[model samples]
Target: MPRPIVLGVVGDSGAGKTTLTRGLIRVLGDEHVARLNADDYHRYDRRMRREMGITPLHPECNHLDILTQHLLHLRRGEPVLKPVYDHRDGTLRAPAYLRPARFLCVEGLLSFHTETLRSAHDVRVFLAPPEDLRRGWKVTRDCTRRQYTTDEVLRELDRREADAIAYIAPQRAYADLIVTFTASRTDDPSHLDADVLLRDSLEHPDLTPLLEVDHGGVALVRRGRDLLLRIPGDLTAAQVTGLEESVWDRMSFASHLRARRLGEFTVGTSLRRSNSLAIVQLIVLYHLVTARATVALGGDPVRSEWSAGVAPEPT
Candidate 1:
């Protein structure tokens, strides 16, 4: 069996981590992918945490040691009894049996919080959308799906802000890619622009050729230690189609993909396709596929060693 390529997607509460993870799973066949949520490792249930004055974002509130152990086991192609966290009511659920698949996609708040956990992934991604945008997303999601009132969501955000600043946001420095989505002039969330930080460590795909498209909305610029990939928000459907083609230009199996364009944005009862989401998923999917290829050629591509460091400020 080829070594499973583990991709870690880390971000704060409403940073679109699950949506991105699901999109990747859809693109890769689900049977070939195993999914995990880091939120499952919380040590205290919602009620307990509240009574103890601790937030889930804090390491003290989570079972990081167990999470680290599980990550190591998963990377070694071993099964684990992974814990479960029910977001709907913030309760701890029964553990689930997880068998390693061809690919592993783990998404949650603290996947990169420890060296042991970080060492288990072949790719690390951090989503850092603007604060306002993230706040809007959080409020909407909690109210609609998690059964919280808008005021309650706002209060929770206030409570988590300190922990987010101290713990969750710092993980961005360790990531190979940092993704941010911002509103366009019209302030439409669905049509938001994407600012992606492609760090120097990974072998990123070159999208330079596609920049010539009229109003391509894709630009690459060098700033200090990273390269930024900017996708404009106002691109037409045809323009987005062109960009999607460029993303898959190098893939020999593009035609056979289970879900080529499968990222969606949901607000209240409305669900619509999002070009920005699809592009982000595609870019990460490209890295996973390449890592798999490296393993096939027997080069030991998966990263099994990790070190701790302070994350640098966004450039």
Candidate 2:
């Protein structure tokens, strides 16, 4: 059985993390998955906020310790006393019971705020939409849902940018997957934008299907003295179609973004050092690195390796 897995989707406000999480929930199904929006972890009550003078976005403002504790409990297969934040009233409504399921998805700002919080995630995905798209989404969301004028929203966004960098940005270095949706170039991005998702694909080190060179087959070629590829072999139409289909499957499996159009970008540990972008990238790297670490430690390589080493040792 798979250990309890927790996936975190972190990004700037209106970066489409919620939409992505919802889509995954539909795909993965509710019976096997649980959702926890990190917004529920905010510290200030509306009255407390009026006194303390801060919103949920501020690091000095939220209950990081309690949120960390709950996540730890959830990972341990225990029910968590989750908080409730009323967006309508801007206050903590009441504590709620959040039971662990097969998969737990925690989505929101500051999900990767601290090492403790970071340790709880098995898969950390960062969603960094382009600045223009993020701003537009925030503007629209604030106006429609948060009851803010355009100017006020923009001002708040500008103010939040600094705090976001300091508190939220550093988390990206640990991300296992970093998703950035680029605006479509063919369309007029200024007026209409299409999302071209990018992923940093980890080459599985096995390219057998990708390089199908055999006797009387396509010739072989080398790239940069590294990227090796086999030339096409003499294949009949049916054989050619089969090879093409197999290659497509290989590409899809290795490709990120669930769509192959984006291709593989790059990933490095250096991503954890920067600010907002770093946090986004680091979160993805963190999961990937953590998964690799588990495999290295002779544990099952999955998102939730933290749940390993809990069972009794056989005498």
Candidate 3:
């Protein structure tokens, strides 16, 4: 087996990092991968922040050395005890169990904040959304997770912008891929185009291998063109071949392959099939670990963290 690849995805808060990670986890399946979130490294709880009048967004407000230790353990293919962040309460809850897996993802605002953490990753991704878009996301995410009202979220965002520039903005230059959704123009874009770009980068192989497997006791909803021959468990060599065969038949353009593009075709996940109750207890591992359809507005692909401040301020 090939040595597992570690991908580090970083960005400012609410930059679609969670959404991208969740989508990939579903596509690749949990058994083959693991994710770590950097948010869990927050140095204080909401009460502590309030008492100290410190915002959680600042890099100085985190226990980064502990984060460094956990990541080093994962890279060595050993088990690790990771700190857990409570999204609802905005604090560290407890420790989490992290097992070794084939592919590991470390994601967060400051995953690449230091050179030591940067050296552990095989691939690096940075996502930065436009000020408005991030504000929009922050509003929605905070409301959902912490029951904060829109106005309150915006207030918090205003105060945090300086910290983002001083701390968060600089990390982008070190990333292999940088994805931003800041809309420069009035019209915004659906995120599908961005997903398409990211999917292209991963460049998954043609559906040949996935088409051969036999799906076990799949529900009626699981049948048809957009289905994958999901091997429910470990397979023997011959069983694996049979699995591949089934997947290929689905991927083949035998009038049944799902459409990938307008004219192009694909197999499986062509249509989103979300179960109301999600499959796993998704705890974003910190420490875990994009692209552009060029939204009509902010479509520039430049890695501008260094010059973001010095560049002429647009009116």
Candidate 4:
């Protein structure tokens, strides 16, 4: 069997990393993908972090060396004794035995912090949601699920801002795709606009023709060697179908993997769908399946032009 294709999703807390990966996982089938949360490799628990006055966003706070080793192992189709971090109480639980599957999705704060770690992934995605939106998300999630008060989450965000700027934000330069979800004109949570920066590190499906449709919902712009794709929140179902069909037509080899829904997410307890989210998810799916095909043919899954440079600021 070809070794598993590794995807690295790096972002700050509450940047929609999990929400973005969840749809891909559903389409890929839970059993076919091995999941790794980099937070599990943290060097300290919550109490220890507070005592030391360090945030998890700081490189010194994570066991990144161990994470790189485990990522290498997984890429070679090997199993690992992965550490577990329980976010509910901010404690490290017993380690879990993880076996590599067809694909490995590693999501975390600093997955791309080092050269070796960045090299382990066939596809690298960075989530760069606007600060206000991310803070709102962090507050809601931490308060409701992680036992953190709103005030506590807000204070923690302020404390981590410096580290986020120094460590987390710089990793965007190493990503093949930079995804930013911003609030729509109406500021509706369910219908947020998506802006995707597609770097030349990977060969993305041609979306130039979609720009000619004049639906006023999707636009693609070129910036030097990269492309910026903008997807609006309120697209009609027919428009979405047409857009999805264009992408699906390019990846007929992976048609069997399209049974599950894309862009299905919950706001609090209510499930909602976003057309822009579906488009973003499908574009990502295209790359994953394309990489799988390339790997099966014994070819490298990523382009060789990838180099470290300043990543464009998110729009």
Best by lDDT: 4
Clashing pairs in 1: none
lDDT at 276 for candidate 4? 86
lDDT of 1 by residue, 1-315 (tens): 876889999999998898788878877888999988889999999899889999999999988899888888888889999999999999999999999998999987898887678768889999999899899989888888898999989998999999999999888878989999898887776788888898866767787777676646578888775689898877788888887788788665545773455667666678777777778878898888888888778886533122334445655
Q: Which stretches of candidate 4 lie above 4 Å from their native place?
A: 308-315
CA lDDT of each prediction against the hidden true structure: 0.83, 0.56, 0.54, 0.90
- Reference-based lDDT, residue 166, model 2: 77
RMSD of 4: 1.7
Instruction: Look at candidate 4 and tell me the lDDT of residue 67.
Output: 97
lDDT of 4 at 131: 99
Error of 1 at 57 (Å): 0.4
Report the C-alpha lDDT of model 3 over 156-259, residue by residue, as the tens digit. Answer: 78777888887888876565445544332234232111211121223222444433444332211122222221222223345434433443353343222122
Q: TM-score of each candidate?
A: 0.93, 0.63, 0.61, 0.97
lDDT per residue (tens digit) for residues 1-315 in model 2: 334567888898878676556544543457867788888888777578656767567877777888888888887778887899876556677789888876688988888777678768766677666787789877876677676789977876786787777766666655545555544433322222222122222222233443454322423233322222232212344544443344335334323323311111211212111112222232233343344345446684442232232211111
Residue range 1-315, candidate 4, lDDT tens digits: 899988888899999999999999999999999999999999999999999999999999999999999999999999999999999999999999999999999999999888888888888999999999999999999999999999999999999999999999989988888999999888777688999999887889999889777766688899888899988888778888888999999999999977889999988899988888888889988988899989899997756544543444443
Candidate 3 regions with alpha-carbon error over 4 angstroms: 1-3, 182-315
